[model samples]
Target chain A: MKIGIIGATGKSGSKIVTEALNRGHQVTALVRNKDKATKLFGGTVTIIAKDAFDITKQDLTNLDVVIDAFSVPLGKHLAYQHIDLAVHLVHLLRETETPRLVFILGAGSLQTDDGLLLDQLKKIPDSQAWIDTPESQTHELDFLRTVTNVNWVGVSPAASFVDGPKTDYALGKDHVLYDANQKSEVSTGTMAVAILDELENPSVHQARFTIRNK
Target chain B: MKIGIIGATGKSGSKIVTEALNRGHQVTALVRNKDKATKLFGGTVTIIAKDAFDITKQDLTNLDVVIDAFSVPLGKHLAYQHIDLAVHLVHLLRETETPRLVFILGAGSLQTDDGLLLDQLKKIPDSQAWIDTPESQTHELDFLRTVTNVNWVGVSPAASFVDGPKTDYALGKDHVLYDANQKSEVSTGTMAVAILDELENPSVHQARFTIRNK
Candidate 1:
């Protein structure tokens, strides 16, 4: 498979690039800084530095799948930036003839009993830094859902998304991710694996699902 | 109308108490800290100090509407402390024969196309702090929707929840609130008014709705 990863230098994005490469798939690492990408990712994959929106159909024309791990800061109000990127990507991918998209979403959108989004994050303290990232991801998901022509899958993490290796976990659609103790904690490696699996198998098309340790 | 305001000493909770009082409604302010309640609220309404979990039918036996402004953190890996409070309040309200519940929710649960929670926010430079509170409120809405016996309405503010007088904005259900400019914003005072009006009129029952400028 040919894969293009946006924000390939990011913690989670880098994992996706490496894992895709390790699987013997051809990977194009889309990044903002080539120097940072080289320092973090080394010369393991093909690296392309371009603005997410500026990348034309020619940029994505040959890729079988596009994985966006692009990031902005936590707590910066950039709904338009994120949403713009998603909308632009949908447009760009459609024009480029790309068929599949796999998005990294936040755990906050999991269904409460009545289907209200858990994005308000009242359960988490305000002092934490990563809280806002979920909101940005959710906004992008909303925009993507409006694009019916695009086949996309939005994957959210568990409530506690710590940095660690993958574990034995299960996945559920439109629900919270639970671990062996039924607690929600997912590692980035597992999340990337789940994304790659989804990218390969093509389930959960145009839907959102969560993955956690079983 | 007779209204009960839970967690009436915190920032938004205290504001709820005042709004209920100003609207000429009989208000019962529930809180844990009597000293803070006394110092901050100063007897503008009836104050009942008790552990939120211990709130009983007798405490709410007389109220017509319960505006649960009470809140607790979602904890490190927990959904929210308020989830228990919401469940407890619904249980008590059902026993006490109270008819309606008006909950203040965070916007985190608002859905994008991929069904991600909007509240899982990432900070973008030049964004405001108030934009993320709606996600938490959305979680509360989810908890409230599970109860069949209680009539409830969850009010989520726009992306920017400004503190000001009422503006009489338009209302939306299960979608982001956007203005003519496509940017979303709302005032806390207007959110209070809309919630109060919903309590009095009782439209869009058992659903989550949003408020934004006209």
Candidate 2:
């Protein structure tokens, strides 16, 4: 299958691109800088360099799937770009079934036994400096929930999302997933594997699911 | 004050444009067709011909306010355009106070004694034909409520919005407004006056308000 990965030079995006290529699927790296993408992928993938907002429906018509791994820095402004870009892509694909969308959202929206994960995150010391990204991503999912005509799926990582390699992982819907050790964590590679597996098999539709390293 | 009215050729937009001009304010009609705007306003207002989605922050930089009176037909595709356009405009004006954005929302989002006004509208027989517009507008307000960075305001009319001459009206926030006769209605003229009155006085900020003929 053909795949397009937005923010293909970012941490999660690069992993997803590598995993997709290893799976023998054709990959297109949709990034803002062709030089960076070419350096990273080394001609292993097609590169479309432009702002994600400038990507048109025509550019996505031929792909089988588009993974939105776009992420903003933790402690800067423009966190609202998460929701803005999601709305932009959703608007472009309204009522279309082909070229399914896979959005990587934060775990802030997950429901916990006590309350929302975001509620707990907000209670953390010094969380205000970077809380807008999760809050905006929550709004992104809220906006996506209202869209019934699009073929889209959302994935949320565990509470302690970090950098690592793939491992045995468990999948659940709308909850902060925890492993047997009561640890809630997922690696970028683990997320990539789970997302690629789902994109290839196609289980979820217009719904959000979560993953954690088991 | 110099103002920009999107969908300036529509029922609500036309009325608002006329009211603004009559009040001796400079108005710029941001419309899709120069001919339609010229025919309606007789070149009384400056015209910027473009789709509402294509409207940019540069086009709005000089204005004191922007009234998004953009509306789609009752029962056709692109009903989602309402929410889409709102997101687009709000996205362009984030973190800015200049050109305060005013959204002309639908009455469906109003709270009622039972639940939301949209919940009742959804149960109406044959409402499936035109319910998408209200549903999208409701989503539009829901989306707006999460936005805190943008200087914005939203206005919803009474349950029965119609076209007529100006009249005295009362204002409320959130709930569906009703007159002494228990009739829920507002003419385009009355809505125009209430909206312009709010714009000029700058009472409501970062919130939604409703109005009905007194």
Candidate 3:
């Protein structure tokens, strides 16, 4: 399968690229910094140097799947881009079902025993600095729910998303998943694996799912 | 004030153009059909012929307010354009307080004593044909509510929006308004007046309001 990964040089994006390549799939790295993408993936992947907002339908029509792993640094006042870029991509892909879109959402949208995880996050001391990203991603999922004609799905990580190797993963829908030890965490490698498996097997559609390391 | 109306030749849009011009404000008619716009507001208003999606930030930066009266014909498959165009315009105007936006939304999003008016709209007999318009407009309001950086306000008319001259109007926030006669209705002229009044007075920032005939 031909796969395109937006923000292919970022944390989860880079890992998804490697995982797709290791599975013998053709990978296209859509990145703003060609130099950084080339340094990260070298000659193994195709690189399209453009901002996520500038990616056109022509660039995506040839692929079987596109993973939106785009992220922004916290406290930059640029968090709204999460929702904006999702809308842009969905608008471009309306009335089509070929290139499946996988939006890497945030855990704040996940349901907790109390209300949303976002409600708890808002209560964290000084959470105002980085709360906008998760809040906007929650809105992103809300917007996606209204879309019916597009073939899109959302994947959210657990409360503690960190950098590590793959492990046995547990998957759930719309809720905060936890391991037996009560740890709600997922590594980038596990996320990449779960996303790839879902892409190949195709279970969830038009809804979001969450992943946690076992 | 310099005002731009996106659907300057349509029902509510034409009335808005007339009302703005009557108030001695400079009006720019932004329409897709140049001939229709010229025929509607010949010599009285400036015209920019372009699709709402094609409108750019540079085109809007000069205007004090841009009224998004864009609408699709009922029963057409183009209802999603409501949310899509709103997202596009909001994305362009992000981080700028200038060019305050007034969105002409549908009454489906207004609150009833039971729940959303959209819930009642869904129960109408054989409503599948035209329900998409209101459904998508409701989603459009949902998307706009998430946006905090943009200076945008939404206006929803009453249950039966019709063609008529101006009338004394009553306003309410987030709920369906009813006249003393127990009828929920509003004329295009009344909607136009309420919108222009809101735009001039600079009230109701980043929120939604509904209007009905008194």
Sort candidate 3 into its docking category. Answer: high
Per-model lDDT? 0.70, 0.93, 0.94
lDDT of 3 by residue, B63-148 (tens): 99999999999999999999999999999999999899989999999999999999899999999989999999999999999889
Off by over 4 Å in 2: none
The per-prediction i-RMS, to one decimal, reads 16.6, 0.6, 0.6
Off by over 4 Å in 3: none
lDDT of 1 by residue, B1-214 (tens): 8788887776567666677788788877888988888887676778889887667778876888877776654332223344435655664554233557777776666665546446336444432344323343454565455444467777777767777777768998877777879888887778777877777677777778888867
Can you write out model 3's per-residue Cα lDDT over A1-214, one digit (the tens) per residue? Answer: 9999999999999999999999999999999999999998899999999989989999999999999999999777999999999989998899999799999999999999999999999999999999999999999999999999999999999999999999989999999998888999999999999999999999999999999999
What TM-score does model 2 achieve against the real structure? 0.98
Answer with 1 or 2, whichever has the higher DockQ.
2
Estimate how well candidate 3 is docked, as a DockQ score: 0.84
Name the top DockQ candidate: 2
Best lDDT goes to which candidate? 3
lDDT digits (tens) for residues A37-80 of candidate 2: 99999989999999998889999999999999998898778889
Model 1, A62-114: lDDT tens per residue? 88888877777666543334544665566555423354777777776777554
TM-score of chain A of 1: 0.89
